[model samples]
Target: MKRTLLAASLALLTGSAFAGTTLDLGYKAHTSSTKDDNGGAYDQPFVKITHFNKADWGTLLAYLKLENPGEIADAQHGKDGKLTVKNLMIIDKQIGDSAYNWWLQNFLVSNRTVMEDNLYLGLTTNRKFDKLFINAGAGLNYSAAHFDPTGASFDGISGGAVVINAIYPMQAFNLKHRLSVNYEGQFARDDEHKSTLGYDSYGHQIITTLKTSLTDTVYTKLHLTHFDSWGSSPNDGIEYGVAIGFNF
Candidate 1:
């Protein structure tokens, strides 16, 4: 099922109907510290690819993330670790000439042993005031979890979230940069196994990116991201990462 979905997404991405397309490849290294482990830090490295398209009516996006590509095993190998593969698909459609839009998003997370899937349907709005851009959304989410290795099954749960994002562009030190802030809060029923599972989560992140144009079709981006998440036992952490992106 996962492979079929991936194939379908790629097929759509390669279709010629889209008016514009952008592809970005990036590498990021992250370290996370948790509260329970005496603030032990875990290292995670990710390779990501993002495909964005502008269609006649709206926009489509597909993102793929591979965490710990080197498969480094240490203290962060199990419940406290990150997923090995994460895939996201998003569609945004404009509502006439209004400032509001409709969006559908799906996410699949897997570690070759366990998998989690989430679907979101929502409304979003984006506005620009002078040099600042603000975007916000509210959504409903349906999530499911599965353990492939053990063939364990669990009931799916429903949730909701509110998300906000802001971006500001600036010129300083003879360079152009963008600062972005994002916050999201998800509320869901506590899982049946509350001691071992968590569903409600909140995250906040700030990113600073420096963009440099290398050519007409190529560009470089260096960015630093600081992120924090809470509301779930053993799932709360602070993470920081640096990444470099190449756009074509």
Candidate 2:
């Protein structure tokens, strides 16, 4: 299933609409516990990658993250650290001369050797404010089955969600700064899977990141997250971290 999804993603990304790419290598710190490999809550170490590009059809956004890198065999990783992969992809296609844009979003998360995936399809609108750009949408969510930490399963058709994401950039003093916000949450749910997700569900998870760079290649980032949950897991907290990396 994973391979098939990846192949399909590659095919969709393959086209003449090639654009620029940015790469960064850095570590993240979480101030609070988050969903982990076993469908439980814990503080984990991670390396994150974010990519954005323009395609003939629309725009593509991909985020790849490796959680609890085995090399850090500490409390976060336990004695035998396990590496996990969490990914998200969004394809935004503008409607023909319409004010709305079609949105297709996919979430793939691998934990305890089991892979969990979800899909969201909806319509969004883009707006600009001086230096900030915003995209907001509403959609339906479908979730696949996955085992929780207790080896129990949670799966089914989750319902309607609304998302609001934005980005802003500016120059302060002698450095360049970029601020971005990502948020998505379900306002409706399917009773059968209302408590499916391991963390931050029913409510929403919002991440706000600010990257300050002295040069084109050197930068520091401050990332903050707010997870408001009203589900089985019940996680409500704020997390802040910093990362230093290169942007090229």
Candidate 3:
């Protein structure tokens, strides 16, 4: 299923250098099949707003995300790792048609009224060749968790995927489409109240999307995302969603 989706998406990037600003709002519902028995089929609704435009100074881009958990068995499922919001800021410099972008992101996750914040910094260089576009970059992240007990907290530092993304836009099967893929593997360290919980953690994710314009201002996207986190503790992932969006 994953490979089929990826191949179909790549088929869209044939020969293009068109760029524009886009905004997306959507939700995904999936069944979880992790090693842990604590998992359940959950429908997560998300609202995302993104802005990207070319400016005299550079190309500026920004995004805001909000996620809601519809149901849960555990409070962690109900309220844990719930109530999350993230924001990203990006600046890009163009040389010819290709560009280099630097970005920073802030993430907040709330569980049972306890909130945690994480920050990440990243840099990427991208090139557009005819109908194919590629991007690569690496980033570092730091996370701080706050607890209500007044004396318990967790902190962590991690390096995230220096990844490559290839996109192909509109040109096959009489349907306009766009396909994108990316990967990441990183090492992490965690400390609680300055005490080591573990010194090993790693994560990886892959997402493939297919999009077509229904009209001049409206588009639809079929996306499938799979993620894995393995090491001392692991978080396996699942996501599949069909989203309809409007573009300006």
Candidate 4:
């Protein structure tokens, strides 16, 4: 089922990008990592891809990082280690040609892998400065489900916190530079499920990456992710990884 959903999303992305699109494919391997909190026993490295465009409709960006092939096959559905799949999209289409932009965001795997099976529907804006492009959105967040890969799972909701995502690509910073920051907060949720299954009331995750081009078609990415599930101990940590990649 998960595989089917992923396939459908890729199809939608391809369809939407038919006219003006850029596709970059690459393989990344984890080289080093460190953190402030307890790290997971198993690693879930991934191949990350991204796309962004502003059109007559509005603006949108899509990102997907499929877990490493060896890790995914070895995960064994939680027996050996927890598996994680990272993918997200943020689109802000113009409202009747008005200056204000409004649209729905997308669902994504939480950095902690829980309390985040949700989407944001609200206002978005696009801005550019120098060589950087940014598309940001903030709105009422509807958490469609709660998934704790550690065992707990349910349908839940977040009482609307600001979800912000942006990208900064520097094509002439000596070396091509790629940077993006994504943040999602869990300020409030349906009280009925709050604190259930050891879940907490507030949480957030900061995912940042800087990819420096190694050559015309090669690069390295510094992945730094801070995850806090309010007070969840094991899931609250700073995850990091260094990767070498090639453009395809």
Best by TM-score: 2
TM-score of model 4 (CA atoms):
0.66
Write down the lDDT that model 2 would get. Answer: 0.64
Which window of ten consecutive residues has the lowest lDDT sum in model 3?
1-10
Cα RMSD of all models vs. native, in order, equals 7.6, 7.2, 6.7, 7.7
lDDT of 2 by residue, 1-248 (tens): 21111122233334234443344555554443454422233445677776666555677889888877764634444545556788989988978755468999998888563456778999988776666677899888877755545454556667777889877776788766777798978766665454445443377778898877656556677788776763212466665677765443
Clash list (residue pairs), candidate 4: none
Lowest lDDT 10-residue stretch of candidate 4:
1-10
**Candidate 4 regions with alpha-carbon error over 4 angstroms:** 1-41, 72-79, 96-99, 110-116, 129-132, 146-153, 169-173, 230-235, 245-248
The 0-to-1 C-alpha lDDT of every candidate, in the order given, reads: 0.57, 0.64, 0.55, 0.56
Question: What is the per-residue lDDT of model 4 for residues 1-248, given as tens digits with 9 covering 90 to 100?
Answer: 21211222233333332212223343332223322233332355556666655566766768776555344533322545334566778777787855568877776664444544567778866555554545555677666445455554556456776666566665565776767787767666666445443436677778798777666555677777776763223346565677765444
Model 2: clashing residue pairs?
none
How close is every model to the real structure, measured as TM-score?
0.70, 0.78, 0.68, 0.66
Work out candidate 3's RMSD over C-alphas: 6.7
Top lDDT hit: 2
What's the distance in Å from true for residue 39, model 3?
4.1
- Which 10 consecutive positions of candidate 2 have the poorest summed lDDT? 1-10
Where does candidate 1 stray beyond 4 Å?
A: 1-32, 35-41, 72-83, 147-152, 193-196, 200-234
Full-model lDDT, candidate 1: 0.57
Superior by lDDT: candidate 2 or candidate 4? 2
The residue-level lDDT of candidate 2 at 166 comes to: 78
